[model samples]
Target chain A: MSAMTHEEVRELLAAHVMELLLPEERASVVAHLAGCAECAREVESLRATSAELALAAPDRSFDARRCNGVRSRLLARTAADRDARARLAAGQLPEREPLSLRPPHATAPESAGGWRTASMVLAASVAGLILFGGSILVQSRRELAQARESESQRQRLIAGLIGPGVRLIELAPTERRPGSARMFWNQTLGAWTFLAYDLAIPAEGRTYQIWLITPDDRRISAGIFTPSADGNAIATTTYALAADSLTAVAVTEEPAGGVDAPSGDIVLLGAAR
Target chain B: MIADVRSPDDADALVTRVAGGDEHALGVLYDRWSPLVFSVCVHILGDDDEAEEAVEETFWQAWRQAERYDVTRGAVATWLTTIARSRALDRLRASRRRQEETMSHLSETKRAAVDATTRRGDDPARSAEVAERRVLVRQALLALPLEQREVLELAYFRGLSQTEIAEHTGQPLGTVKTRVRLAMEKLRDRLGILRERDA
Candidate 1:
């Protein structure tokens, strides 16, 4: 080993490729390769194998973090499939069509407010992910749905008409809480259609209620409602909403049967406005 | 005791480690074979997005499907390279891309990012060569008459259903069928002749 030239040693280093040689093999490989030229040739061949094992990895900055997000969402969506379908059918929160992914470069940040509004709609739309469980090869199908384009939303000034005497209300965001509903007097629909958007999903087994105002100004009952997937509540007569008794639409915590109205502390207050 | 994983023993140990969720061991496997995989994906599917997407899906799929990976059939690297290649082919088909057309514009951006990263790492040119070599392999693959190469590329790299490949290539369907069985026979013959010459 001591007699070997540096170049010969370097060649054998190929056979024994590494950052540093181990203590046991270090003395032996170094000893023979010092004098033997053919043994040295073998080392060069060995070196190629090590060189072939380069250590580059994919960039981990963005996609690695995104992978964790994908996994959690995949698990949650798969588990909650049943509840999602039930709610969609109950309230008829219109099912959105699949949207194709636009090239990221096609669109750029222009205005802040427009994006903020659009993103809110986008966030709700993406909640329904396509199933990609283990039936097929382990590939996933977690797609995002797009909110209907704004032009379509704006052009469609859709109106709902209740019975001759119906209660209609608008839910606005309040300083303390996000949800607040106010009744509107639309003589066309008689009964009120509660338009609540700022409200988040109510607690399990509980719902928001609408109340009618009697001529004496005493609060009467309208109907109870469960929130849609997007957390907006609509007044449905399937349960208890009757023809017009003009008052206000106040959402109160109610049991399954519901109260005569205005009994619970009002979560939303939509008076004729 | 080994510097390179070239033996049966080494392959077995690595598989054991992989099955145990050893990501570093997975890294070791990746370091050893990513070039083969990346090359194959780029070759079969011209688009970089589909290739990278295929590779990512392939690695994750391999991780989840580790229990099923068998060692008797072929080398682990070959198995993995095959997986990535298959996914890339599937993506290419899904996108309905022609043999030369790229499906994702984002892939070009990714290549730029890789080039920049490599330059910062020192031998940026060598890093670029690694990418170039894959393109060359693709060019070589494309040079083969559309008949045999399509079968070989699809059967070997893309992992298409034979029927599916038959449908896409629009060959006699039976002509597509024989091409794969014959192409593999030719690949083996070429490898055998090379081995004999080396001997």
Candidate 2:
């Protein structure tokens, strides 16, 4: 085989380190390194160094407060979503509940209980406790499991979202505005997730509106948002992109009765490319 | 009776559960390693708030893609750390001016797990040799150029694929390959003699 140039060898160095060499390339590099003491030595040191860093990398958890905060926020939002869905189904007002509160369990009224015999009461209490405790345990385990699965999903998506030249724009906080929006827009994907961090939800008659700016700088109505319990405005459906036409995603105040145009001013912007 | 559980098996089980569209499992998985993963980010980024957000965002992503885990490759810590590192690095790369500077800071702040292993000097000569070699490895790593050290870490430590590495680095595919090769060659040359001498 002809002698490899320094550049050729250098190029091969990376592939070899990764063990990415095709069968022929792997063989050639292996063979060359065996006889080429200088090259062979370099590969060893590099591998050693990589191993060191990886091993040395501190594998500690982030701030407990931050993690707990996320869980609390998610839990609050999920509960609100459940309640809203329930209220929507019941045709009743969307009753908001705090973390310290829970929905009243369905059970017979107290009059039905007082007339019952002592045995019946004992049996009923036992059964009720069993049912309640079992349900809570199952639900909590289920919820915890859901959190784990969500974490995994987040990891993969974040991996995909991350690439060369990808830009992340964090929207400034919307001060005291209940119908506000926050954003994480990726110009590469031309996609954004409009989140309601802490918005005082609009009345049942009113809703939040999201607008997207076209590449030519014209504003396009994208979608509408409603804050879940905990006032989190989560986008139900992801917005589609139009090449680089996306400039920014803005949320405006609209009438309790919805409108075709400017219900309010721009609440948040991602400044999409 | 089953002994104490492990993170790896839980990770595997969590992946299976997630594949079935169970969100609770995702949370459990996040709780187990979010700290370790976040620490990796903070270590790489050297900022608490940024690291915290990165971890939160990472779990949000994990919820959607847990089914992709393949257990035969490596440990869960390795896989998650790889992801965390990638995210942290992406943030670092986005702030171009901070890249070169953050690295030196990393080097300064960095500490090797030199004596972490339980082996002792009184052990067999081979064990001693292995321990010594490991220490040398750590030393050799701190000596590499920032680029090579990083690519090397992501590949061997985190087990990222070449294409993924290329995508993460944002360099042209060919250029990435070339840079890895050059880096390996340099590292190989440095360690070749030590390895041979030890052998």
Candidate 3:
């Protein structure tokens, strides 16, 4: 390609940083940057400015539960990849039981070779058996640990509800809705236990989201939950903020996964006392 | 584990660990940056499901390409946001293609209704430094002339080429290019502190 003039290259730098240049123009800009110091510096600075545009987008409140699910899946996939690489490096095939360890009801292939093959198959079976037993023990231990963690979480929640420094905030239904709720905010523990009753079931593909309004009127997502068929729901979450900074609490009906901001009508409202 | 306080150095260290196959470091990075990434995706895609999918793809790409990250190019947050915007735009373009083929009859009003479903709210839970930076960036964007800001928004968020933006806005191609250049330079000037800090 013929060399573009300095003026032409500089004009395209902004568009290039925004990824808005046509393919040919982008190629020309890339080529020019390789040979032009000034254009390269300008492009880098413009690119950094372009990136800051992302901050202009409003924050969307993601469902914490859903976020956790995504993180878990990501970690699992990475772990699986790591294990496969390790196994490959160690000269082992992917995880699978030896044929000799198949259930007794399954048919076994006839011995196709002599004592060497037989000895290897025997050794494989023994190794598979040991691995299977080890996995079972590990699984049991993991389950026990999980159970203990769950119990401990429950204990913490109970303590937060009944412990000293817990303040009760009574939520009254707005004129447009029919529900009453209460919040047990333990500022010292940074725990919140919310319980609502007589709330109408949200429309299909909708759920109730709780928001903590700061004194400055900034709304922060506490959590999202759906009421039971009998018009009752409970949710617990932890947030760390100065007690005096919170001014009010409100609930709104939002899309199934909830929204980053309150766009729906307020269903219940309460002032932090 | 997610730390209560994070600096640019900490973020760089996290990326290095991620490059070395540290899953915990990856998790901390995800926790620290996913909200901003998700927000960008939602702004571009305007659909939660697609945006969520884009977030997953962005971080997964980050995980696979961690070793290629260049701190000299920009900060970690900026790098992640760049990846996020690219992923979201890819999804947006693909979905538009599908819509053109299967839902050609869909009216512009109906399409707009879908976009309207995305709501906006501040995440006060974010670090004070991030929130302050957000305020500063927003102020700079708002201070731009309407025409200049319009061109930048169309190109950045809507992923429109200069020629396409000219067509969309019924302006001349040269005018569109000029507007983009002016807007970016002004933004660079207004957000100079960010540039210095990233340096």
Candidate 4:
């Protein structure tokens, strides 16, 4: 397409907003839109107007079953998407035909092996978790499996601490427990390794909860884990709180799956300063 | 379970969680907007199966591209609708090409007679605000001049480019562009006024 003046391109602004411009025409209009504030506002206004079309449909009847079907399909697709990304990141999938990582404007269907590959990756990840003592970084919704996977993940975090810029925060031994704990954090990677020394293992139904105190006094659950038969437990988790925003780190005994807040006896309190 | 009502803040929060790879948040977002997304698809594809596929593709794309979603561009619903519209058009355009190739054997009227029924019989607006907004939106579209509305629908719902719309309507390309621009200008003014009133 030949170069068009600003006025000429403005005529196509509506169509451009609707994404009706062919690629070259789109490129021209996009170029014009960049330097022309007036044209850009027009485009935004047109876009807002177009978005309202979503409301223009007739009252659609509610179908719980249909909604559920779509929900399940979306959930499965999302899971598959995450698995594919994880596999690609892990170099487990074929590099030549990586999962489609197209930009938002361009998307393609997953290859036939996409879901099968995802399942394989997930199984492998879970197997790896088991071999590492059942702690793994997984996005699965199964709480029991997640709890088990978290344990092995904790071990990995502890192992990763010695590699780089790791900061160790000491947890003074509490009166009720004679055990001492140390929290090792890799500030750059935002990984935490909690080592509880001589901490007593809770009964089968209970676990130790690690908490991160934000400057705003908000306590976020880091993870939940039980000590081994030897009364020593290590937990590792990815926490993104910066050193300044993190007020302190603490561990408390709580029921499995952790809680919204620290609701149990504090076994160890570590000053993050 | 996804709640029956979700505020705008809820939509933003769900998207944030989705960006963090939270499948449950994605599910909640899907449940919240599936009707609107499906409606856009059905209106464009005019076929249940293709529309269903578009819905799946839209959410799947949303999952993959959640991080790219810019709130400054529009809300979560707007972002999802835009994606749905694009996907539906892709399907519609492919079917259109296939029909054109078979045009030697099939009539245009027959081709246009493909199943246009939506998957559901009733409006799926679970909240009063959504239902009211739908009524206002329909009114706004209806308020547009017939000529403008015709080109707007062709460009938007039918996924026709300006040139294609010109060809379809037997109008000059300039005329088609003018109609689309006029339509958007009117809708923009009208919706702006409505928003101010609501505010």
Q: Which number leads on TM-score? A: 3
> How good is the docking of model 2, as DockQ?
0.15
Better of 2 and 3 by lDDT: 3
True contacts kept of each: 0.00, 0.34, 0.64, 0.61
User: What are the per-residue Cα lDDT tens digits for candidate 1 across B131-173?
Assistant: 3432333333334455665554444434445565566556675
- Write the residue-wise lDDT of candidate 2 on A94-133 in tens digits: 3332221111122222231122111001111111111121
Which of the two candidates, 1 or 3, achieves a greater lDDT against the reference? Answer: 3
Please give the lDDT score at residue A165 for candidate 1.
30
Model 2 deviation from native, Cα RMSD in Å = 20.3
RMSD of 3: 20.7
Interface RMSD of each: 14.5, 10.2, 4.3, 5.1
Ranking by DockQ: 3, 4, 2, 1
In terms of lDDT, model 3 sits at 0.67
Which residue runs of candidate 2 sit more than 4 Å off their true CA positions? Answer: A1-55, A59-61, A72-273, B1-7, B97-199
TM-score of each: 0.34, 0.37, 0.57, 0.56
Chain B structural similarity (TM-score) per candidate: 0.59, 0.52, 0.82, 0.81
Which runs of model 4 end up more than 4 angstroms from their true locations? A62-65, A87-91, A94-273, B1-7, B101-122, B193-199
For B2-61, candidate 4 gives per-residue lDDT tens digits of 121123676788888888999888877887788878877877776766787788789888
lDDT by candidate, in order shown: 0.42, 0.48, 0.67, 0.64
The sequence of per-residue lDDT tens digits that candidate 3 reaches over residues A207-248 is 888888777777877777776565766566655557687788
What would the per-residue lDDT of candidate 3 be over residues B1-199, giving only the tens digit for each residue? 0121123688899999999989789888888888888888887887877787788788878887899998777767778888999999999888877875233322332333233223236763255656666666677777787778777777887677898778766899999999999989898888783356446
Candidate 3 docking classification: acceptable
